[model samples]
Target: MTHDLPYNGSASLDALLDAAVDAIIISDDEGTIVQFNSAAERLFGYAAADIIGQNLTTLMPPPDRNQHGQYMSRYLNSGQPAIIGIGREVTGLHASGRTVPVHLSVGEIKSGGRERFVGILRDLSEQKKYEAAVITLESQLAHADRLVALGELTAGMAHEINQPLTAIAAFSDAGARLIDNDNDAARTELKNICGRISQQARRAGDVIARLRRLSQKGELSKSSHDLQRLVQSALQLFDHEVRRSNAAIATHFNHRTKLVPVDEIQIQQVLVNLIKNSLDALAESATEPAQVHVHVEEEDEHLYIIVEDNGPGVDPENEPHLFEPFFTTKDHGVGLGLSICRNIAVAHGGNLRYKRSERGGARFTLSLPLTYIG
Candidate 1:
């Protein structure tokens, strides 16, 4: 790359300085502009001829404009320069009175017993806009990740709520028929039916409550929660869905109860997401006697919650990009469930990992610091 420069010719030097993309401005030791190229004109929104004889400070905003001369005098007196031979980001004042972010590089030239300074500035206005655009995009992706979880849970949640609703309807009909009879046997039956109705009402509320907790938008409030209960909560939330999907769920807790310091809801979200993915894989593969196994075990100081399914395993090729934002092999929306799950685990000082289950299916393990035993 160094050998490619046309270092021996004056024409090459002129072309390199004038035709180059970066704006170059040369000023005399007195801080008066001496040379301004075409690129400088395009960048500063000024004509070269109009700016050549003016003070270099004219191109700077008030604070820098007023202080640049002092800095130059200090450099000349002490041979200590602040910006010369140093490149950094600074503000540039355009002829249109607009401030632009710029990358600035300064160099000195000594010729014919006179001193000059050359400044190279790269405009960053568009780059700033691009950065803002990317920030907005990432914010949208985060929101989309949460919405996707809700979408996946909607089907199972519908089934969960309807089960209790159907029970309440049946009990109501039976209670109504008994009330009209007004006999001792009928009254006793009515009382039993009322209790069943209350139980179903609470069950329905539990389903809605699960959805509400997961949908809440707020910062994570972490505490020491029982790991076993947390896993059970996720299973209970998906109980009706498992039955509806013609899948079986088996849970094993070797470390029956361990208190882990983490955001309970966030960890629950990860487990639920893993379960949903497992169910989807099972459905697609049409696996006979579809099964999802969730096991909790404590190895040394770490507690592991493993969700494994008897379905199609992950493709070796897609494993690398699985956790990347918006990278999906599916025919639907952005693939962010696993990515978000991993983020949640990491934020809790834990890890979420994937591997091949013994049953030849995808296995996800979420491990946390086992803080206490209860």
Candidate 2:
């Protein structure tokens, strides 16, 4: 049921304007303020008496203040509107000499052979503060996820470092046994042994450096990096896990792929999570000749990093919850890996998606925009 309320003309309109929660100001065609309501007075810390005859630009900061008159002229002369009918986020000047974030919408009115513009502005300071807080919390959660993944890879990383150290020890022993020989052949063998030792030492250092990088917690910093090289680095970090699972790892990369802008450590974390999940699935299925295929390709203005494995695919019922926080299939899993991975992808203006592979296994794709501003 509906009932009509009695209209009281200008008196009712005046009451409505003052009752509004947002600031509402009316200005003439010459940009001089004509109406300033109670809400506007409270919002700008100026009484209607003081601001009634002032220019509407008094509420705007520098650039906007200086250009507003021109904008008004252009719109009036050419019928080309910028903010007259549309709403936009802009900076506003406060009476306290501070800048405030606000969303402003303007409408035009012609009355009694005169033109007037009404502006409705809502403060956005609280909204912006909330958005910033959410970003910070997400970053902290991503850092925690990285630390958990590193903990799980501790054994594999130890084995990786030990291989080079063992080789160096054997090379050193060979050099020591040949130290007493004076023949040219013995000298040549010793030189070769010393060279091998140096190579092994450098290899060990590289492993340690990779571990250090993954474990470090810092702000998200973006730079141009080769996607192919980043994928290889992630694979290297999982070398021991691959061997332990006896999984066959294969990579297909487009040589023409160009460098992309991303936070290297964060992207690597996503890659590591996908690869680790595939190997774990393969191990569980005990599939004959297990295989994990990683493919990098560029298409439709986006870059895709796909990881698929020939193992038991995810159950159809659980697919929807795979990326939800605290949702897991493994008995001892915390269920934050995929959640964090997806968050990291979205933060970069990209996304992570999952589907069944042609090889009858789970396939996960991380898609990123090639021209991402971040």
Candidate 3:
């Protein structure tokens, strides 16, 4: 079983290394570069003759450049592995003084009792650029979706603000009338009217504030928020629609773990979309005494916000295309809501799923992990 290849000579090995598509570098135990293949020379902007015999650390960026020797020493002395066989993405120092993204794998070689190490590197700059571009596109899409949703809710938002404004106007008129009486009883009544006006003004301000927050276009910012409160806020946006459609809304919240880390605006957008969809479905079905229930529960280190309606559910054939972009069941729908919602959920290290409800209706569950990694 001791068969040796005819291409074992230095010249043949050099030719094989040069022919490889990925850059290959071989260094002695002391971290001195001994063999710099042509691919490596092209990747690092250094000629093989210039890089050979130099310290391997010369090719690394600072931080890594300063610590690579220590890493090698630690592995050689302790026989422990950090990234010897395990490959990972890292930054490479190019001769042009620019940092390049690369995936690197290292292996050890022992020949005639001397230890050497071989490193293989693949450029990851294009992959990173593509990923960043994708993130930008998703952000833009989510923002556009939010604006569309807000546009649809314009009527409800106007109704919400109008109620408080109407009350404030009535209270203000009564206060003006009492100003002419000047009696003790009239003065007391005037104070009560003034308080009512202030309260109504605050109520109107709150409605406007909620609308402003949801309609805002910006980057995804994560923070701790009460899930139940977020759901309630979203429901407020549909008050007029729910009343007009004669729909009954119910909610159950688990207060024990209601707080979660998420981009509040985006999460609220998801809630708004789901609740609106449920309301729309109920409206279309004309189900007797339409009912929509929202429940928040915590199980197995995950938080779930479930929205279900007692209306016509999705057809079996349409289930598979629910999350596809530009697919819709509505006559005037652009169909990006579910797709964007699912992307937001996944971006937060969670998920969105649909299922048949116990009451024979459509049910959507948004699950978010309690421990957020982002």
Query: Which has the greatest lDDT?
Result: 3
Of the two candidates 1 and 2, the one with more favorable TM-score, higher being better, is 2
Candidate 1 Cα lDDT to native: 0.81
- What is candidate 1's lDDT per residue for 1-374, written digit by digit as tens? 01122123265555677887999887878888776777888889988767777898988997899999998999888988799888888888999998778999999988767778889999987887676567557646966776676578877898999999999999998887778896899988888899999999999999988765564435667888888888898777664466458899999999854677878888888998899889878988988889999998888788889999989989989888777756776666457678878877776767899888998899999988766322
* Shift in Å, residue 217, candidate 1: 4.7
Candidate 2 residue 354 C-alpha distance from true site, Å: 44
**Candidate 1 has which clashing residue pairs, if any?**
none
Model 2: per-residue lDDT, tens digit, 276-308?
899889989978889999999888888999999
lDDT value, residue 183 of candidate 3: 94
After superposition on all CA atoms, what RMSD does each candidate show versus the true structure? 22.2, 22.1, 22.4
Ranking by lDDT: 3, 2, 1
- Against the true structure, what is each candidate's TM-score? 0.43, 0.46, 0.46
Between candidates 1 and 3, the TM-score winner: 3
Candidate 1 local lDDT, residue 261: 80
Candidate 1 residue spans exceeding 4 A from truth: 1-16, 28-31, 62-89, 98-101, 107-117, 125-162, 180-192, 217-374
- lDDT (C-alpha) at residue 32 in model 1: 80
* Reference-based lDDT, each prediction: 0.81, 0.83, 0.84
Lowest lDDT sum, 10 consecutive residues, model 3, at 1-10
Query: Which segments of candidate 2 are over 4 A away from where they belong?
Result: 1-9, 138-159, 171-374
